[model samples]
Target: MSAPFDLARQRFLTRCTVVSLPKPSPGAPPPSVVYYMHRDCRVQDNWAMVRASQLAREHSVPLKVFYPLFPSFGNMSSRQYSFQLAGLAAVEAELRELRVAFHLDHSSPPAAAVPAFAAAHGAIAVVTDHLPLRLLRSTNAAVAAELDALPGPVPLIQVDAANVVPVWEASGKREVGARTLRPKIGKLYGRFLTQFPPVPKMPAGSPLPPPTDWSAARAALKVAQVPDAPGLTAGTAAGMAHFRGFCETRLKKYAAVRNDPNEDAQSGMSPWVRFGQVGFQRLALDARKLGKHGEGVAAFIEEGVVRRELSDNFCFYNEEYDNLKGAAGWARESLELHNKDKREYTYTLAQFEKGETHDDLWNAAQLQLVGEGRMHGFMRMYWAKKILEWTESAEQALEWGLLLNDKYAMDGSCPNGYVGVAWSVMGTHDMGWKERDVFGKIRFMNYAGCKRKFQIEPFVSRYPPAAENCRKAGGEVALAPGVKAGKKKQKKA
Candidate 1:
């Protein structure tokens, strides 16, 4: 294997994995180095982008960004696509300013599409962001294989742009819990949690093409019909603005009330982080400066860096990340023991998806996710556990929970979502609690439990019954929070 690239801050090279190295060529030099923008979409504070640009400059080649847009990925809808496309539009504009050509490939199995794009562009090397999920890992492997087969054997390099300390570097095996992973991350934070060097202006080698037609891009997706999230805006600028607002406002209360569903205390940057519109490292760096909110900053770092990275570790090392098989031996054994325990209430996937359940709080949480494209972090635990309580088996609960989360939440289809649902339903990354009928040793959540934490009734009131149900009764359905029901217009003369 070739030695790591001679980029500044040799420590940063630890964040990269050289999957394959290019063969020395005896022909004309390639024209560009291709950076396949996938998980990390932003043009700034992106290590993969930075590394790719540096590689391009080293070889005296232009940098080209190849983005493969799948027609449908991760059970996404128009809501997710709209947000993603909007972000990519901004990425294209930013790349234009840097004189880096942006190419969008409407392709599948990015492994094939990416290498082909690189070869077509005469790329000497391919660099892409790393993700720890099964699909992403497998795709990366396949891409590496294809790149190795090319005439020049173009190098395929991966940068862990999403996590502060790279996943593989943090731990070689799956961590038991945040407790196990936290110390490891804490040790490395000093070395990894530093400021990012700006992606400098590229050497002018090639003229850029006209900007991407985002409308046509959206038209190409065969996604679900979910509407855009009402209030949340997409793109790095909006995401950065939101993070600043969180630090200025909600962050002070984050440590105290982040778990209370009634308070807006959590940093609402999950969607941005999920979409890679902004780097979590940037957020962590800025948050650390707020020494005034010492407790809050500590809590944010724990959750954002420690817990988030833990999720990546879980998904990275475990192949069955989305299912019961991914659970620990203790969790799986306990779940199996309780698999046939009679559930007081069992709901089908349809009922779960439509938020038609007996529990008002559960239904409200479901409605919140369906309508708002997000559920509070605290409620998500409850929301998923109830699926276990009401589902036929732990396997079904895992399946349904993942499906619903990925379909509705903008941050769905990520390592965090997989681990969150797994933690809730199968007790992954958690110790077994007192044995219960359906829950076995898996931790149980209930309506009374939610009441103890927050004002369930008011939270329920914020999200009334499902809209379709109310409409079926010929009644005016209450809208989501911040969207007032406008007065009906009088009949025209």
Candidate 2:
């Protein structure tokens, strides 16, 4: 492959997986190179797309980007579809400027869609981005199978464009935690973290895939009930601008106030990053350049690269990623030990969805997730742990947690969401803690701990429980605001 385009190919051939290599066909007009935009959706800073462009240039073939759009993706609704399509609209525009054709295939299953599209387009090679999630992985496998079955088979290649360090290269097995995976990525980051080369403009002539029919696309969506987030704009440009704003203003305080829900200290880039509108490597590279915010930069790297990639590593290596089966042996045993324990509070999925839980803080967090499409990072830990506390079994808890997260959060259905919920309920990457009644050995989080960490009232006040929820919680809603647990003012006798 001409000594592999750059350092990425040189250091770790694992960065790209060669599924099938078809022999060159005798033809006059060279075949096209297909870049299937899946996990990483951006125009630039995407290794998968870059590699496809390189292959097209080398083979003297036209370059094309195809996104197989399903009417519905998992539990995703209009909220997610709107954001995704908006970003894709930008992708079409950018690819047009670069003179590359962008095709939107509204096929039911991408596995079928991708190979059929390649065959129809006379593709010589198909390059795509990697996603560890089961659906995408299965789709990749099925596509590879279909490609191999074709009369004139073409090579199928995958690039790990999502993570700063490729998941497979980072670790071969499911890592126990960030501690185990951090060093492995640290050793390899120098080689993989280098700046991405531009995806050179393709020679003109191939018609730009008609400007995406976004309205028709939206109208065709099967899941359109969920409302889109209020102020969240979707596009690489907006995502980059958000990151720049964070670096300029919020980054300095990120280290200190990130845990405080009341502070707007988060990077707020998850929706963009998760949707592949922005790349993690880009975030890390940009953050590393801000030496002035050293502490924040370090913390950001810990979260963005080490922690985030750790989630990817977990999902990629562990087949049972979203359930109790994926938990550590000790964690599984501990959860099993506590499975029969009585719960002081148990709420149905409907109640949980409505934020009708007794704890106002938990209710507020749930409200934030439903209303804003995300919850505070600190609160998410408390939120999921409480599910384990209130649900019937560890299994049910994991189920409910995943359901809610996948249904609500903009970044839901990704490895990070799976790992986050697993960490909270099943202790996937966390160690067993001191045994407790409902939680057993898994890490425990409570309202009091949150109160100690941040001003609970300000955050809770922002998303107050509905009056009906307050009534259901036995009128404790008034006590939640600014009042510490166990110190609520006693009613006058």
Candidate 3:
């Protein structure tokens, strides 16, 4: 079996497409197949599942969904773990309804878990969704390599369902900015923006695998130590409900107020999109149909599809995306030039995590993420660029930002998060701006800028400054800056 054939050639005509991988000799039973891992987690509107089912139907094989759970990864937090498990539970139920088996590999990497499961099930061809992250990408590649090394051929097909316009179809080279990529995405939108076909029903196989036990799965997550934040639900049903509400009400004024944190004008759909609970293509289709809100819909689509896909493109093609070394030449040169500039203040990663910086707006932005697992998009830029300004090094700023983001944010550990941090810290997806300390010619964001744009009092009031005694405690209670430092003590006393 060869590498997964590119299925984008079939366009969006059908939810599924056949990948003509090299077949085994005649008279052999059809392959028992599984999809390795990736973004299209949902059964409905998932091209990978569609393609996998199509293959199963074509070869008269049994199809199953395999998602491996390794609790040791760096970015796997309790919050993320809980979110994924809940979503997978939903996926398990959905797949069961379709009479397909779903397996949970809790002990090993996908390479070990998936192939072993496939071999056990007598799977001949395995199809997985494409992802841009280093670990997952390597995992899929390794799985394919291992399968090839086996005695008989076991084809692995990778489907691109995360992006509205396929990543490859968007552009061959990295886009310089949204402006450059906007028209390219606009041109191709019509071709890819279409409704998701209902998940085709397959004949019931004899008593499909047992549904994943959500309780057991949650208990098994032994990764990072962060306590779970409350009120963060996960599932495709929730994602679709949120999307429908946004399209019906918020899409009208999205262009006007998306940047206003207080308005909550932006569609809080990134976490859903990141988790692949809702299809990007589906969002694009609905946005186009919004006649009265066309401008707003277009604006939202630009960020949701074009800008979002560009992040995947960057991470996919460039291994160094998470570092300052991957920044544009202009940003690199400018940052080096200002390496010795005087700084008003310097904050350690710990201080930043606690939202301890002098700026209230920055703290508010940090609070939004830490407290709620999300931040307003505009505030995210302000939050990260300030890290570059206040940190010891550009590299340190990037490190701290990425660390904090992945640890706390629900939508973190994504291409958008990496590119966003880089863009804020090192100007990767942006151009030169007015020269400034720490940042030099790279984009600069200031408390005054945020103050000018939105009402800060409400935000500041929302996350009150930490108390001194609590701050000094240096535990969960010490997570806030003002509390640890006794800054809030004077006012309270």
In Å, residue 179's CA in model 3 sits off its true spot by: 2.2
lDDT of 1 by residue, 135-241 (tens): 77777778877777776667777788888888878887989998899889888887787777678788776878677777777888887798888998899999999
Better of 2 and 3 by TM-score: 2
Model 3, residue 237: distance off in Å is 0.7
* Window of ten residues with lowest summed lDDT in model 3: 9-18
lDDT score of model 1?
A: 0.82
| Candidate 2 regions with alpha-carbon error over 4 angstroms | 1-30, 466-468, 478-493
Q: How would the candidate models be sorted by lDDT, starting from the highest?
A: 2, 1, 3
Candidate 2 lDDT for residue 212: 74
Give the TM-scores of the predictions, in the order they appear.
0.89, 0.92, 0.88
lDDT of each: 0.82, 0.82, 0.74
lDDT of 3: 0.74
User: How far off is residue 217 in model 2, in Å?
Assistant: 2.5
Q: Which regions in candidate 1 have their CA more than 4 angstroms from the true location?
A: 1-30, 107-109, 466-493
lDDT of 1 at 239: 97
